[model samples]
Target: MGQIYDLAIIGGGVNGCGIARDAVGRGNSVFLCEMNDLASGTSSWSTKLIHGGLRYLEYYDFKLVRHALLEREVLWQIAPHIIRPLRFVLPHHAGLRPAWLLRLGLFLYDYIGGRKLLPPTRTLDLTRDETGKPLAPGRFKRGFEYSDCSVDDARLVVLTARDAADRGADIRTRTRATEIRQADGMWQVTVQDTATGDRSTISARTLVNAGGPWVENVLAVGAGVNAKAKVRLVQGSHIVVPKLYNHDRAYIFQNADGRIVFAIPYQDDFTLIGTTDIDYDGDPADVKISTDEINYLCKSVSEYLARPVLAEDVVWTYSGVRPLYDDGANEAKAATRDYVFELDLPGGLPLLSIYGGKITTYRRLAEEALQKLAPYLKGTKAKEGWTADAALPGGDFDVSAVDALIAELLRDYPFLTPAHANRLAHAYGTRAAKMLGTAKSPADLGQAFGATLTEREVRYLMANEWAVRAEDIVWRRSKLGLRLSKDEIAVLDQWLQANRAQPANPMREAGARS
Candidate 1:
């Protein structure tokens, strides 16, 4: 007898949140539930690029490449604070594909996507260009530079969910959809609160299973629906090390194995090198970087860099299992990155399940999802193509104005250091002032949890951002975990536990599971 929503999405990854935002913007009643925190799955563990998948051209996936290539500027324009253009340096390897092929790929990449805002590709002289300063001498003589955009992947998901909430969509974190059944032409879903062990049932006209790697399990176990489509769980791992180069440009090194590896500037002090693709059959939640993956990453990047990266140089490592649609590709790296939707409308009730998508195409996927469900959703005044022009929360300003915003914040809060102010502007954009709240001194902001993470910011995250655990604030919300000591993290965790009931704003609860 609970409220019957127009759509009940069972996941909090980027795709689910994106769909919720688009659906709610169109004036549909939406309810989204996540068993864990937002972006805690493969969403956060991306290579963090809004790119056209230049490597995918070998497989002749021209449609997928063109679609993602076009989204690069679109995402950058909307979320300028978190998404910005990043030039990638592709060093020519003599043993790999010919330079002409690389040039052709870049040429296709430049023109296929209707690229306008980003600069076109150009050949680089490794002997003279600054981009080659950190490369091994005589190993790489020529390179190609192309455009893509880097993203704060976790923040993208959080902001999308926040925008949905602002538009009247209910977003519940730490709530798992335990069961789903069709009853009287509607879906009866049973969801459980992971924290409090409370259970509730809600009804919805349509259901969405955006469970990422758990998409198949959700269909078989949660909904009791047999899925005709299968998901191939491929594990990709990455490693973070001390800064490999002083410049901001990232590197794309082609390996002899026909796969590519990226060495991207990360967190101001580290370089992110990654991604080994291997078939994964274990539980997705338990995926972790293996010794072989680390060794492979180190060796792969060491081949091109001036200094060799060893296991001792690794600062951190993380892994995620990608739920790619099984196309029977012999190699895991060859699996299609395009999204597939399986809509089952048995007895006239809709259950849509998603599989195999990359971060760059999540917006397009969401738009397509809504279009598919539009037939089942009656009487809802929903529209399409609204998200293309809509800016995410706190991202209303132009991308070029971030520096000016930082300067304004400095003038207002003279007590903030330059680094702290810059960090805040990048993370929260215009909403940084909300966390500052007339504070004039460091003490006014509250207890420092290392690396400019103040109690004020923590409380702001809890109240406005649906953050509860220390890891949520330290790892996902921000990468302050790399700087905070274990003792500092423990203190913050203890304080959070002690102040659970005393949120900064009591009225704005962190998505109560009604």
Candidate 2:
């Protein structure tokens, strides 16, 4: 066996990354491999809301809703820059879910999570409150206001990976584990780097499969066996358009079929509406937003909005398949978003697999997975769980202090514009100082890579963050690609050609072993 690892995790989604962060913090040497850019899968395709799942109350999923609602605050305190409180408006309808049921659900939502910093849910007068200004007369009479949190899903995954690496875990993005086998009481794994087509091998005491929608695929194709082949795949899609209205509050409108739709303020200039449930059977990577889904979502929004949401209004759209633990639910909409863990000690080498988890409960899911697989470690010792209070990378400061922190940063470097300072604060939080360094003026920053990206940030991403491809910088590390010109992207491509790392003649990396 090669150098022993306490855990080797496949798939760099939120669940895998969170487990890496948690396991490494517990003194377990870890190796995490991802086939594509980190969080490039379903982990990044969520509606980007971290709520207590108020709608889940209808199905008696009170436990999940309460946990999610509670995590809304916990994660906000840890990563205030990327996560913040947002108000949602539930317009009272003449027919759908009676006011009494909605009221009781709100009451339980507030009390179930042990209500804290967030404001309590309250009755709204659609005609009086500023939140109801853009409504059509006679359409909206009353509503309710409740609190939830929005997140940059990609960054959350990256921060988890960053924290795990800082804790001494080795992260291998753009690398795919081709095969795993148990030999002589140890697990042998072969990995191929997708970029350069380089292959190598490694060995670990335990293997973890957290491949999100590809969980079953990994077990069948990579592990070469159908282990726990009792999972279901359900597709959910979202669409983006120019911000529909100027209100800061979101609207949740129930459709004719008892399903709900959300119209949210996105990127300060766009509105994000989504999520239609459809049964999926194809490869997850190949899933795309269908025209029917687009029409369905738009019609749902049209039912409540003063302005109808037409297909032309959609600027961007995406789709993701949720790997649900099949509970034999007939309807995709009624399926559970909760997770399950399957631990098998084949050849005395433990393999822990994960399935069906939402963003809100990833941390707790990681803790539980660790405990479930703890006994498999045998005589080898590992740290106990303690990630609850720990601050993730750049999340040490509370949200209340963000303004003060930004003010101090700007005071030190007056040359930086407010946009630059805010962007840095948003990406790096207090740790923006490390990226800013001693640059006194804009010229001190390296080449302009478009959007708000500076050369300095590029170098920082290459050195600290596991940024490899140009797409990694444009899409994941930063959303600058959405705002940059074509010429600017060309410049980034040129810069990447010059800075590509030279691998050894052996044609293998240190972490590649079978």
RMSD (Cα, Å) for all candidates, in order, is: 2.3, 4.2
The runs of at least 3 residues in candidate 2 whose Cα sits more than 4 Å from the true structure, single-residue gaps closed, are 222-225, 378-384, 502-514
Tell how far residue 91 is off in model 2, in angstroms: 0.6
lDDT agreement of model 1 with the native: 0.91
- List candidate 1 segments past 4 Å from native: 506-514
- Give residue 471's error in model 1 in angstroms: 0.7
Q: Give the TM-score of candidate 1.
A: 0.97
lDDT (Cα, tens digit) per residue for candidate 1, span 299-360 = 99999988999999998889999999999999999999999999987677889999999999
Error of 1 at 11 (Å): 0.7
Candidate 2 residue-wise lDDT, 222-255, digit = tens? 5645576467888999999888898789988889
State the lDDT at 49 in candidate 1.
Answer: 91
